[model samples]
Target: MLWEALGAARDLGRVHDIAAVLIRYGFGDLVQRLGMARALERAGKVLHLRGQDDIARLEPAARVRRALEELGPTFVKLGQILATRADLFPPDWIAEFGKLQDAAPAVPFEAIRAQLAEDLGDLPENIFAELDTTPLAAASLAQVHRARLADGTPVALKVRRPGIRPVIEADLRLLARLAEIVEAEAPDLRRYRPREVVRQFAHSLRRELDFSAEGRNAERIAASFADQPEIVVPRIHWQWSGERLNVQDFIEGVPGRAVAALPEGFDRRLLARRGARAVLKMVLEDGFFHADPHQGNVFYLPDNRLAFIDFGMVGRLPEARRYEVAELLHGLVDRDGGLVTQVLLGWSDAAEADSESLRADIDRFVDEYHGVPLKQLDFGAMLGDVVGILREHGLALPPDLALMIKAFITLEGLGRQLDPDFDIAGEAAPYLREVILAHHAPDAIAKRGWRGLVSVADLLAGLPHDLARLLRIARRGSLKLEVDVPPLKAFGDQLDRAASRLTMGIVTAALIVGSSIALTVNRSDSVSLIGLLGFVGAMLGGLWVLVSVWRGGR
Candidate 1:
């Protein structure tokens, strides 16, 4: 574990900082429970705990969001990831997490130019014709600047912030340890799956830090839409791209957020429809999509085309998962509660839940949306309601699915922003139908049947050997069976502790009895002194036993 003594020593300063933030946010109890307080004290670190009561007056969710913000980029990104977990948190918590923004003050141009020069193997002037010192945008990990190539092609240069890797790495290390502590010590927070969340976030953040990976993601998405002239991804200038630097064609169009600034002839409704269809195709048809499609990541070009940028975050759905999603969406539209319930249960990787209760809830939800016009229906709200039900039933969507849902919600919101009457349900209908039809086609069934047959045949071929091995193990008396029953194991641990305490009590009593007899038979001062020492030792041992019992009682 990263929180082991050796590893924690290396990160003692970071631990102190994190604990200080938590305490300042009125989470000192959490800090103590996680053993951070004890560890910090052992390292001789003083924690400032003043002003906590004032911060405690704020709502818990708000306090957590503020703490994350203060903790810097890694935690802000974590909060953003948490914002997508509708099935793990209630609406209030999710809303608070959504408030986290990635904006940060830009690193100075002089420092950036030094890194850029090293990355480019020469000065910035030697590569690009002109590079602007002013940053176009600055974010938590990187900043973008406008530049022009030698041939006069305009481009945007995305440069990783100098010395960011070490800071983020330290934060990630502390986060890993913190997640472990929360999982082991805070049973109430265990349902949130802190370890799994941190693991996913770490993987995602690392991939995002690699500018080359973002370039590759952009190319892949661009290739996916090569035949469609309406959707555009910036052409990657890989000659200058690397782990720390990305160069791509600059998009010179109306920013997606500036709806009022669109050229006089641009059609908002058409743009909305096209954007929705493009995202649906990526998700349902291509099985890969942009995880974040917010206004900042999109631009509007002439002829009503859309330009999507920033491939830092994306989602991929396997073939099986794509089909399941299609089924779920089809069921929702058709008001088939049973189908929806089945798809949901299949997605839940937890222990069996109350299927009948879940089915009833799904039916009620479906009925609530029944007869609603497609144009008037709120698809995002519907998805949120479904996720709320899953939350109530103690089920959470897998990480990929959670990202997909968040993307869908963002897409719908963007659509409505462009056109007041935009209908995501109507726009998604055709793509969903195609996916469902493709899954049930005759060729698809035959392909699945052939795969299943191969699996069964392999199993049959290996059956005799497996049985022979099992028989041999049994004959040698080496067979083993293991059962994991948490309650019984817990009771056994308690028994072990109680037995140890009882043994200590018996030893203490024996010392007291022997010492009392020695005191009565003492003929010299030394014997009496020895007897007195024995009595003192007995008293200390008795106190230990009493304290152990008292603590165990709680």
Candidate 2:
């Protein structure tokens, strides 16, 4: 009945379209292995599925990227998320997925005029001094236009596409169903955790679709860095923001990617250091960070202040995880391979492997770089190497933890692009040091100890009740213990058969001895019944033992 329900769901949702798309990209085997081939057959018969003619000509990574792009926004977002998972995917695959584009044609302004006016509480003319119909940027989810307030304050107005939510919501449903099917049907994919990845993607998409959520994120991050004059986060105007639309202060600065086009006299070195410091602080201290800090999402103001945009995807860590990560980085600094190994394993419940071997691998990674001075070490290259090792060892990080790795990698890349002598390690060292000190501080230790003692006391308080319940069950003769013993069952049976044979041999020996003694003593008593009976018993026992051995061997 459960399978039937799943089958019906497969037919009802977009699984058919999804399967057809996979088949077109030469991923028909994946579809079959996921137990969706029957649905694919039905879809194929209806749609007359045709594989891409030149699919075989492309590399596997390129094929995957192309398939995702053709599948639409949800899959593209999945690809984008996968691109951040450097510790799971190969470098080539990550590179290919990084190219997943969400660009879409702009929606007509007339179509969204009502939504915009509604979100803003009035028409554009009534609420703003001026508004531009032409979009400053367009994407599958939303588009932004340049606007100005009645008080002459410049702002960026983001408008959601007229009917995109339903489409995205439908795709999300199909993806959730498909993820469940994939996890259940394919054991090899279990380690990759397709279900968990999809869950994270769904959560992220929910946050992304609501412009107000993004506004809130911007506000929180802005507050985190409020004291730092070197960094800028756009001010969100909540009065005009809603689930579908957002309004924020317009930033007038050069995009970080176009460093060559910047006017002369700009201090690239200063910009690079400030950028690295800002991001490092966010990860190691603030515990909240913009996960995507690629060159495009950054802007450079005239005073060398760096601005971050796009709060759609963010990463957060609690204090505990933050401390662990900081210690991991510090381990890298001190060349403490064991500490690094411990921290990495603590980050996720990865498959068990040889801890010594993993530690050795970390030692090798650190030894190759830690000896070099901080400023001279290639931090980006070292990080890439670590990611490769992690993938090889099946130590893929959880989604939120992986985001910090990606963020740091992005910051290093940006730094290197702006200044060849950029020092990521140097910039991150002080923050990590502070975290490490706090981690071992006396007050922190005492607090942790108190928490542990409270947990132990709670357990003690419940011990008597648990013991009474167990004793009551045993007394009532209703105690049942469930155990896994398939491996032991055969061994137990063999031991039982051996013990029976040994007992039979002992009985036979005793009978023989008694029979001999009786025969000797009754030699003159002609035809003694006791001796005859003893001999018969011995013979019978011997035969039984022989038969048992033969049967057991067979």
Candidate 3:
């Protein structure tokens, strides 16, 4: 079905590959339902539907992870994106998704040299004083190499893998179509919001594909921290940067993953606190933050300073969302269950849920930490429990908030890795307080009031035209009113059933009377045979009436 609807011959090959991978992962039934198997078979792509017992024995989450790994870079990126959707998936699923590393075998320098030369506007040897042929790191989308400018400024050359755009774009097209098909055909999977998730992923991935966007992100974050010396964002060199290439000052420091390599003088506790504070400020105060703060994206410099790199994926919160987050944190800290419930309900997009049950759960969650000190509270655990409550009620957070929550959790985990006694809530307390105070400040209140007044003025200004249009439509007898009253509809259904039973009973009675008269007045063989048939039909109708009456208890 989707193959015909998609109508792209170029995607058929990708579909075959996806179907083969899914079938190998014991998801053949899904492929069948999605019509991939039939479509591919029709297109002459043979798929092996058996011999996956080894992989099929693993747990569902692990199997999915393995399948994603086998499916290539685009699916791995999808799995990585799914890791941030804790509100939509359980812990097991999220854990499996989190395990999806972007690591890939390095594409040899020679393969990418032509593209690099084009983006750099010169040969690498001509522009850089020293350029390493071997990549420092390789990922699904790009690889990094150490280089130095002609002026001896050490920088990192982030180069997009040659011919990656077409591959990724093709995958995105298939994913969008699959999401549509899933939403339309799979009722049970609708809660996952496949279409919405795909839309968000496409936007993020497209932005990530453009190295210039990542450069812009780095500059913005560096500007935000220009005054702070502790938080280091690499300086983006734009002269040689473009959609396919990013050149930035490379910080030489202890990689975050190499915790054992920390120098003896490094202050782990202070580092943890500083990290927490920086991220909290980014999310709460700045309304923009790096979405992926995993170990590989971070480095610890001497003097306990932190360097954050790789701004390919970032999150943004609008002013309203930031305020809502503050309110949520405020409610949790103050043990205000009502406020917490209100904010959570505002964030969820579920059409229907048990509100009273959700509120009760929130109240219980709040009471669990009623008197807990700020320093003793675990912000990560608290957020996890909140996500659990949302999941229980079949609610999912908006994509932006989901990314923010994932960042928060990752930050807390990184903090704990560095310092066993790290307290995220303690680090977040001051920022939350500032946000709450700002919300109530006189100027802020007056500004909101002024906006409200302006909105009302605009509505009042447009009321007369609306009334005139309505009056004109009414004069033309074109006005229509539609009402949906549940009780009335139910009553109407009952009346319809009663009328149908009454008509059936009347027809049965007429048949019985007519058959009896024919049997009594006509003794001829033909007439008698017709009367007997009528009698049998009347008996069958009577039985039907009796069954209906019994079933309906009428």
Best by lDDT: 1
Which regions of candidate 1 deviate over 4 angstroms?
Answer: 5-8, 48-51, 177-193, 484-554
lDDT of 3 at 55: 86
lDDT of 3 at 266: 91
For model 3, state the Cα shift of residue 364 in Å.
2.4
> What would you estimate as the lDDT of candidate 3?
0.88
Per-residue lDDT over 36-149 for candidate 3, one digit per residue giving the tens place of the 0 to 100 score: 877886787788777466887899999999999988888898999888887778999989998898999999999999999999898999999999999999999999999999
Residue pairs with backbone overlap in model 1? none
lDDT of 2 by residue, 279-365 (tens): 887888888899899877899998888999989889998889989988888788788888988987776576575677788899888
Candidate 2, residue 204: lDDT = 94
Candidate 3: where are CA atoms >4 Å away? 466-554
Better of 1 and 2 by TM-score: 1
Q: By lDDT, highest first, what's the ranking?
A: 1, 3, 2
| Model 3 TM-score on a 0 to 1 scale | 0.84
lDDT of 1 by residue, 1-554 (tens): 23463354666777888889998898887777667776776678887666556787999999999999999888899999989999998999999999999999999999887889998889999999999999999999999999999999999999999888877888887778778777665666666678888998999999999999999999999999999999999999988999999999999999978977787889999999999989998999998899989889989999999999999999999888999998998898889999999999888765568999999999999999889888998899989999999999988788899999999999999899889899998898888888878889999999999999999999999999999999999999999999866557658889999999899888889989988888898768888888899899989989999888875663
Of candidates 3 and 2, the better by lDDT: 3
Tell me which residue pairs clash in candidate 3.
Answer: none
- What are the TM-scores, per candidate, against the unseen true structure? 0.90, 0.82, 0.84
Report the Cα lDDT for residue 217, model 2.
90
What do the candidate models score in CA lDDT, each in turn? 0.89, 0.83, 0.88
Model 1 RMSD vs true structure = 3.2
